[model samples]
Target: MPTARIYQRPKNAMQSGKARTDRWQLEYEPAEPQRPDPLTGWAGSGDTRGQIRLGFPTMEAAVAYAEREGVAYTVVPAPTKTLKLQSYADNFK
Candidate 1:
């Protein structure tokens, strides 16, 4: 006599690491790095265009700042500012 065996799908698949990874990819896989806006956040000269600052959030924003400010931006400034505005409104006073 011969016996046959059957395989069942895993019930735990949904909670598995692969499933988590898949969910992450499906929900919010990160985008390619972009030039970030420096002014939008708490950094730089309230200039939307700024060089790639490690802390501001993105590189695109930095470059835009350079272009807008007419800075020598063959390269991005490393988040360096001399007497950089503590806040954008500081200049208004």
Candidate 2:
């Protein structure tokens, strides 16, 4: 069976606002291996799985779609950030 993944999109490191964190993504795991092209002598672009990223507004919606499509998927939770907010003046302390 082809395997898939359902996961919440983590906030980009440079992102200060929570614009994209609320969206979840569904992606398939690559079933092929990267092979070198004989003609070009360069590694062929075989990471086709990441070419399609299905985004949903909620995690439940993402999961539901995967189930409805009969896709075997594993949910990967987003990493939690526990940093306390600090002020610029706190640096002086």
Scored by TM-score, the top model is 2
Q: Each candidate: RMSD to true structure? A: 27.2, 2.2
Model 1 TM-score, 2 decimals: 0.22
Tens digits of per-residue lDDT for model 1, 52-87: 222222345544544565544343223322454488
Residue range 1-93, candidate 2, lDDT tens digits: 667898887777786877878788999887787688999988756667657889999889988988898888999988887889999999999
Error at 64, model 1, angstroms:
0.5
In order of appearance, the predictions have TM-scores of 0.22, 0.79
- Residue 89 accuracy (lDDT) in model 1: 81
Give the poorly placed runs of model 1, Cα more than 4 Å off.
1-55, 76-93
Q: What's the lDDT for candidate 1?
A: 0.33
